[model samples]
Target: MQPINKMKIQFDSKSANEAFARVVVSAFASQLDPTLEELAELKTAVSEAVTNSIIHGYEQMEGIIYMECRLFPESIEVIVRDEGVGIEDIEKARTPTYTSKPELERSGMGFSVMESFMDTLEIQSKVGKGTAIIMTKKFSQQKDRSFSSER
Candidate 1:
């Protein structure tokens, strides 16, 4: 019920860093007693977010990707931020089958996959500035809790 312990990682534009982030974050969350299903979902969501930052945000340019992992006893928080070209419109970006780069064969499902995998997804961006995505998912419970319920 107290504040969660967290760690932040900064990596250069590299595909291997994305994979490492996914594995490390998933493993960190796994220590919280998360189920295998939950772990897989978290990994997928992290991958989508990191891949977006590396490919879309930076556009393969030389930029840094910032990832923060907050480990709570009952939940986890992962924030991926980039100072590359920010999203012009977050709403349009989240739309299914929406890809800015069709030539790259992007499925435009990054936001969708993140939404489906995580309990919550929020994106903040500004043109010529950057984009930051905050994703949070709590540990599974036997009973469903409504929005009005306590965390």
Candidate 2:
């Protein structure tokens, strides 16, 4: 909540927009001197959230995706929001390998990956309304432990 720097950007909910989200998030966080691993995790998490918004939330149709990055002195928070068909079952959605569209090759790992990458991941969705994801990671002087694997 208390970030040293804050940034906000909005882009179309398209697959192409995913790259922008990742790049911008990484660039903004670069000011903190986060490790490459940390930056990658941030990018991956952002990609998942933005992809979900574009693929599921907006159903690939043209829509807007709002992303906010808050860089704290010892932590970071990224919020992604979409004004599209909201999630019906947030509990189930959070479950690993749970995808509303299984046929879409989606691993349903969006929420799972976000949870794994960040210290906190929260999702709020309402049917026919929209979905918002709030992800936060607190940095520690200790070695990076946000994930089990180095990659």
Candidate 3:
């Protein structure tokens, strides 16, 4: 299905930008008229993805983070990407409580949180290249009038 709407945003990989990214996505997703719980879930998922890119991907160094959101009739897809170090083992990274940087006291639950909050989570990474996280959520109550009749 074609996207009803789409938005792309690029920003520096800084911890401060994490909140900004979440808010931006929340606002963009507001058009869907999701319930408060759904909105909070999306915001939390976005926060996790952005934080992972800033901390794990860039390792607190300078880098760029790209995010794109696409709105479909009943679902929204979000992509968060970074240009920095990538995960060597995606499976290991997905494991609960598995952290590459133990010195930082990382919780290592970012991916888990994203997976729990979103309908689907996909990760693509290459060492020395970067990492990209794609997440999608289907709205149970769609606000788009164009598709309301189908319901």
Candidate 4:
């Protein structure tokens, strides 16, 4: 389905940019009229996605991160991508408390947080290429209009 509103951004993959990505995404999601809790969750999810790109994808090396937010009638889709050393095992990476860099003492709950906050999450990656974390969230305050006409 085509999005009613969409926004995309590309920024340096610095740890500092994590907050920038979150605020950008959350601002885009505001058009959906989500509750405060929904907004907070979306921010947290965006933070995790961007951090994963910087921390795991680039391993803190210099890189670029791309983010896209698409708004539908009742939900929003967010995509965070990076071109860096990709994951060897997507399944293992999604597991709770799994950190590729255990020495960093990371909580390793990025994926878990994203999964819990968003309605759905999809990951795409290729070794030596990059990773994309695509997530969608449905706002409880907005009713689904896609199927209403059918009834």
Candidate 5:
């Protein structure tokens, strides 16, 4: 299906931009009129993905983070990408509490949180290239107030 709306943003992978990324994506998704809970979920998932890019993808060095949000009739698709060291094993990285950087106090729950909150989560990475996370969430339709009035 064609996207109703789309937005792309690129910024330095500073730890500061994690919150910025969440807010931007949340604002873009506001067009969908999602419930408060859904909005919160999206924000949290975005935070996880962006944080992973900054911490794991770039290792807190200087790099670029790319974010894209596309709105469909009933869903929103978000992609967060970074050009840094990629995951050697996607499966191992997805495991809960399997942090590769124990020294940094990384929780290793980033992927787990994304998987739990969003309807779908996909990760693409190359050992020397970078990593990209694609996530999609379908919003539930609001109740038809007009139908209640008619009844």
Candidate 6:
């Protein structure tokens, strides 16, 4: 399947940019006419993915984070990639309340939150390389609209 529209951006892995990433992705997803709840969920997922990159991936140091968003008729796919220390155990990272840095008081719910908000979550990583988080969500409200028919 081909995407109707897609965007890619790379930014410094700074904590402030987390909000920027969310706004960019949310705006891109808005074209789908998703409900506010759906949009908020997407933003939240993006927040978690980006925050993870800034905190765990780069260890709060300077690095790069890549974010991509692809839009379809009634769904969106988002990919967040970071070139930092890759996760040692992807499975453990996905577990609820599993924080690699418990000292920081992280709830360790990043993956869990993303999974709950998006329909699917995929994680790929290589030690000393980086990690990529791919997520997808379908817009039920948009599916009901059938904009073509309305036109």
Which stretches of candidate 4 lie above 4 Å from their native place?
Answer: 142-151
lDDT of 6 by residue, 63-117 (tens): 9999999999889999999999999999999999999999999999999999999
- Residues 20-104 of candidate 2: C-alpha lDDT, one tens digit per residue: 8999999998766678888899899999999999999999999999999998877889999999999988999899998989888
**Residue-wise lDDT of candidate 3 within 102-133, one digit each (tens)?**
89988988889999999999999999999999
**Candidate 1 lDDT:** 0.88
**Backbone N/Cα/C clashes per model:** 0, 1, 0, 0, 0, 0
* Candidate 6 residue spans exceeding 4 A from truth: 142-151
Q: Which scores higher on lDDT, 3 or 4?
A: 3
What TM-scores do the predictions have? 0.90, 0.90, 0.92, 0.92, 0.94, 0.94
TM-score of 6: 0.94
lDDT ranking, best first? 6, 5, 3, 4, 2, 1
lDDT tens per residue, model 4, 56-130: 899999999999889998899999999999999999999999988899989889899999999999999999999
Q: Per-model C-alpha lDDT, please?
A: 0.88, 0.89, 0.92, 0.90, 0.92, 0.94
- Model 3: lDDT equals 0.92
Candidate 5 per-residue lDDT, tens place, 1-151, comes to 8999999999998988988998998899887777889999999999999999888899889999999999997899999999899999999999999999999888888889999999999999999899999999999988564663564
Error of 3 at 139 (Å): 1.1
Query: What TM-score number comes out for model 2?
Result: 0.90
What C-alpha lDDT, on a 0 to 100 scale, does residue 144 get in candidate 1? 42
Candidate with the greatest lDDT versus the true structure: 6
Report the candidate with higher lDDT, 4 versus 6.
6
